[model samples]
Target: MSVDPEDIEPTYRWPVPPAGGWTADDLDRLPNLPPHTELIDGMLAFVSPQTMFHSRAIDFFTWHLHSLAPQGLEVVREFTIDIDCHNRPEPDVLVVDEAAILGMEQTRFPAESVLLAIEVVSPDSVARDRSLKPAKYAGAGIPHFWRVENADGRAVVYVYELDPATRGYGAAGIFHARLKVDVPFPIDLDLNEITAKRRRAE
Candidate 1:
């Protein structure tokens, strides 16, 4: 009585990009693009399926950040940053100025409004997360960056702080067991239990 989904011919088509390629604003107008679709160097980069490791690490870091962020800052997860006309990359988590939240419908944050950006490495996103995204975030002058990697079933965080002279991030620390930071507000986290379910004390 009902047509099976696989039996129906897909009517959707991938949009042919303009001569100059897709701009950041095109991301808003594109049809059927998957969530967290990125525009880098005027090209579209689709987000790959997430793993448990990736999702949990995001939850862990974002949870800690939301709890500790300063009064005038807000923590957001899985939102894109409108870095420029050609780049709108989404970090796993970000801390932004409270004023930058224009409304409930706003989808992207201005780069200058962001205080910190964090990315969690996935198998499919290794290059972008490790190299491309960080460079872009730094060039935009965001003050802080962190990259989380899965290592032997645990989370390892690489921290960086931007240098006003070079406009690139300088290594802050690499935390495997515990994470402690001063900039972007103080945060201390235990890495060993990052993926474990939090159980409230009785």
Candidate 2:
């Protein structure tokens, strides 16, 4: 029988250790993370809880990104990337440079030359994406980051530009319906379509 997406269990959320710490071995040694858990900054962040809005946003963004088919770029969904020996984050959406993809063996995007990384905020992941993951992504020199917030049957998309000095995302802007970005490539994203699909009753 096919597993129901809504029936899935969520993972645990805990405080992250200090920076410049925790090797890949340390991460691998932990009990196998449930499909919903994402590793961020050497800590486990629970995700994929009961949130249709969040899931819809991710689906919509990926659809729009894939339609672009912009040369020299690739859009990946839920793929783990080894940002460093200590950090491997599976961002919701990734737009990576073609060169970065050429070196990968399978289903991985290199941290470097990642033009944009996007995360859809969940009750369990807001802190990690807004605070922890951005620092790690920026430190690895990722140029841009996007955050999606679903509230009150509406969705908001936030844009963040990476600052190497701070190694964090600087909030650039927010969009309610449509979001456009020149980086990674030139294309427009229609968030309204995604949100509308989510709001439609089952």
Q: What is the lDDT of residue 158 in candidate 2?
A: 84
Tens-digit per-residue lDDT, 1-202, candidate 2: 9999889998676445557655544555556556645555556655556578777777777878888857788887787777877677888888877777665556456688678888888887788878888778888888888888876777888898977677767888888877877765766876777666335578
Residue 147 of model 1: what lDDT?
96
Residue by residue across 1-202, what tens digits does model 1's lDDT show? 9989999897867788899888999999988898889899899998879999998888888898899987999999999999999999999999999999999999899999999999999999999988899999999999999999998888899999999999998999999999988887888888887766669999
- lDDT against true structure, model 1: 0.91
Q: Residue 119 of candidate 2: its Cα lDDT?
A: 86
Clashing pairs in 1: none
- lDDT score of residue 53 within candidate 1: 91
The alpha-carbon deviation from the true structure for residue 147 of candidate 1, after best TM-score superposition, in angstroms, is: 0.3
**TM-score of each prediction:** 0.92, 0.75
In model 1, the runs with Cα more than 4 Å from the true position are 1-8, 197-202
